[model samples]
Target chain A: MPSAEEAADAVDVTALLERGRTLATPVLKKAVDRLAPPMNTVAAYHFGWIDAAGNPADGDGGKAVRPALAVLSAQAAGAAPEVGVPGAVAVELVHNFSLLHDDLMDGDEQRRHRDTVWKVHGPAQAILVGDALFALGNEVLLEIASVDAGRATRRLTTATRALIDGQAQDISYEHRERVSVEECLEMEGNKTGALLACASSIGAVLGGADDVTADALEKYGYHLGLAFQAVDDLLGIWGDPESTGKQTWSDLRQRKKSLPVVAALAAGGPASERLGELLAADAKNNDFDNFSEAEFAARAALIEEAGGRQWTADEARRQHKIALEALDTVQMPATVRAQFAALADFVVVRKR
Target chain B: MPSAEEAADAVDVTALLERGRTLATPVLKKAVDRLAPPMNTVAAYHFGWIDAAGNPADGDGGKAVRPALAVLSAQAAGAAPEVGVPGAVAVELVHNFSLLHDDLMDGDEQRRHRDTVWKVHGPAQAILVGDALFALGNEVLLEIASVDAGRATRRLTTATRALIDGQAQDISYEHRERVSVEECLEMEGNKTGALLACASSIGAVLGGADDVTADALEKYGYHLGLAFQAVDDLLGIWGDPESTGKQTWSDLRQRKKSLPVVAALAAGGPASERLGELLAADAKNNDFDNFSEAEFAARAALIEEAGGRQWTADEARRQHKIALEALDTVQMPATVRAQFAALADFVVVRKR
Candidate 1:
């Protein structure tokens, strides 16, 4: 018999995501349209609906995975996917809001293979646009004008606080000399897991699911977010630049203390020691100005040799298994459970 | 007989602000405490509750004007002052959130005679902390978990969007050659008026007032905000630097197209024409690199000669009158109405 993973892989995730986008995009567009002139223009460009010069364009706008989670979550609670449209739009807006601010904070120039909002419109507009999107997200949720909507807004704002805390921790870690694997995981959980948890449960909560069910779905998403981050960490170090829309060893260039780096430094050996020394020296010099492509490649090789690569990959699988197990605990429809499992699998093993 | 303004001005505005601060500070501190580590530290410092080293200090945590409006609105609706605490905290948090981000975007180094958060910590922390405070504001309102809470949240978020829109317009205006007084008023209305309107009415909404009463209170606050901004504009240019905590002719040095500048340009005289030319030339060069305090003072003199100062002062009085008129349309306790008038008088004439 085929393994459970293989069975889960049979799910048509592309169709699921397409359904979510189909349902959520119009509402999302309406919210963005409410923004004033230049903000509306900037947000439109950021969403890939327009070119930098404001002409219409068909560009990548992510996979709409968060929205899919939300719609699926409402369905898991035996409600129509339409019941979750507001929640889906709210999560997507919050996700994009974070991206805009994070891009500016990280000094990143490009995203989705195009110039970032800050790069094109300058930092002020980026800040304002991110703020506008965030406010728009809250507006969308509260406009529901029900007790459940209040509960949902509370969840979103709480998750947002965690997300911001994670960003703060991430920035602080860049300047520190040593970071434990536990510390790294906590940061990742807050940064990535918290919002995903909110995305996974907010729709169900809005759909009038009991707290027990909502909490279970949130646990599923929390674990899935950890799995997703591990895969992203791996890609940051070793994935194909074409797939990631980034340069090779992109994380190394930014001197990020991602999971792989933290795990490797924790695994003590000659190779680990040497890897630590190299990173310390690079950090002390504070700039990769004198470094070359060969240097970054060498660092990546050292991390792999120190077992960082294999460890992170195993952690991803481990978290994916836990995520699926959380789904099994919830008494949802088999098809809904299967969809959640498929999303977990996709999160772990996807190239980008 | 004494004029209404003189009678209203006798209401001891300082005591009113003090009462607001006393009622609102603890809850505000509790909300700030919920923020994760470094964010909490940055926020405490920003609110003037602590020094850079985290020692407690009695800093000027604003005049608590927004909170007073919220509490008084609730009282006017026949609810206790305590019923308005959540709304007061939400508006105060939003105000500080905007200040943090705006200070960074404006590249302002000091606030209230202290280094700004961005200057003391870094740009990334400033952005993150501002975002955290905003999320916290939403959390405070929605945690009430009622339909009314949802309505209040929607109002706050809508106002927040308008606030962000106004900021966007302000930034865009900086790059343009000319801005009409009407355009400037629109921007100020969105930026300052919206939030104040929300503050003034949210408590009443939460206190179970009907829409008409809430709307009347909103109008009262909106006009008050316009009047308040006018006084702020006057202080920006010609107020004593010792009281303003800024250099003389501060707005002119930054080349701000505040109400005074816009109104003066609209006055259409030789001084207005000369002032416009000077500003246009300054914009063409795009930097005040070679400008001196004397030049800024000369610009201020030209604005005053063009009737900008007189027009703005008159405008403040007009808006204040309208704000009081809004209060007359609402049926409330006489004492409550008197307090509202007192606050309006204070806003129009306050030095700082």
Candidate 2:
């Protein structure tokens, strides 16, 4: 395997993501266009292909990380990048499906600095459009009419179930006063890890790679997902508002039981005790309306003082190292391995 | 083909439906059981397997008509009934997924003499559970790991898209002041017909039936779905409330654009004109809250007087006949054909 410095120098992360998006977008658009009227419009808008009024607009359509993983995984399995387009499209669709529903459930108004589908079209359209995209994802795979497609679909659906299970857990945890770090990790694994794992390996599965190689790639993606989510949780509290497109102490404002909060609570220091009391006070009141900016800043400070921030940063590095190690178990071209490593590095350190 | 009299005499519709439920219930339960905690609880409750608090209870989980079609289609394809269990479970899951989402979209509080998933649990859980079920449906098919399973999953996803399209049309139609009879039929054909078509042919596809026979079976089920929906629309307006487990003039109460209402509006007579004026009044007011039972009864009388009742009844019969004729195009055992014919007849004549 290439050393970390070599891997970073060998690949341009921005160009790789752009290439993956370029390869997958046409197929994704074609699949989505099959949807009937209002749903088609809603989906197009959510994908940032158009504005709310149905006019053409260039908007942010995520970072295309999942699609890049899919295309790279296929290449690692010794196939042309084109062989992974269906997997890339399917993964992107499923990821957006979760986003549409999660936005509604979380009651988030804006995503990527635009109104969410539920905010613009109401909840019904959001649910229906999300459902259509999921069905479209499965259809794209099965239309390949190969047994590999069937196996890939099984993998996709299994990951989808895990993703849903994670969402369910996330919601339930919001209502509870106590959540262990272990429980939080499990939830993140299901919610984030499973789908990323599928995205990473599904292309290889579709490329008819043996189970061992596909599994190794899946492990790589799964650990990468945990690392990515850890970075996300950290940013949710400490990110610059301009870069994250959210308010300061965003996770605290939402009373989200994110990794940093759970980790601090588990640390059992004086700062952790005070953090727990403050959060419990917020929970008891059942609203954050009266919370001052200083109050949120204080909570963030307490979490960091309790060593939550350092632990999480360490955890991210640990998971990233493990993810790269997984890739070493499978034989692939050095360039492909370097690309995967570069992507993992990008995920662990992304600002958004 | 046997005469209608002979077909009806040969098979007991109640026994057939019961047998289908018996065959499919275990696999369906197993699939639902795979869902994580609260979703599993919510799905169990939605399926009438348990009460609100999660204790075991025998509630009404639909009539199992789709499952019966699936199993019978497999039998007609010259396979043992057991071969169709996966298709039956998958179709049933998709059916209930739509129901859970539709009840939320339509603002329905009760179904099958009980509170809906959204009503008891909440809209978010309803959406999540419904999505979980949809994923489970695809998983059931693809886990079979054969090309035929892949084909069946493709057919299932396609039908699901059509069903969603129909729902989009249905929701859109509710807001408009005018809807033509042709448009209404097309909507119902998509909303109801497509899923039934998949249910009928998916088993045959799984059983490796030739496309011709599978297509014939699909045609039969599509017509049967229309016939079934016509009968439902009729019962929604005119059947005894006790028999239907609903209030009088249920469709009128919800302002649903059912077949009868659309047909009545298209009759172009004085009674049709009166019906239009009355409905337009309700639409203009944007609330049925002030409308009395007597007013709803009068609208029902106007619809019947406008020849809507006769046209709908005749349409159901015509569709039923076409369904029977489609069966004639396929070469199957006499008993299998008879069972299909019997099921169609029962659908047209059912009270609920």
Model 1 C-alpha lDDT per residue in residues B254-281, reported as the tens digit of each score: 7788999999999998999999999988
DockQ of 2: 0.87
Each prediction's DockQ against the real complex: 0.82, 0.87
Instruction: Give the TM-score of chain A in candidate 2.
Output: 0.98
Q: How accurate is candidate 2 locally (lDDT)?
A: 0.91
TM-score of each: 0.96, 0.98
**Top of the candidates by lDDT:** 2
Clashing pairs in 1: none
Candidate 1 segments whose C-alpha is farther than 4 A from its true place: A1-7, B1-10, B285-287
lDDT of 1 by residue, A1-352 (tens): 5555666778899998899899999999999999998999999999999999999998898978899999999988899888889999999999999999999999999999999999999999899999999999998988788888888888899889889999989998988999999999999999999989988988899889888998888898898999999999999989899999998889998899998999999999988999999998888785576688899999988899899999999999988888888887788877787788888877887988
- DockQ-derived CAPRI band for the predicted complex in model 1: high
Candidate closest to the true structure, highest TM-score: 2
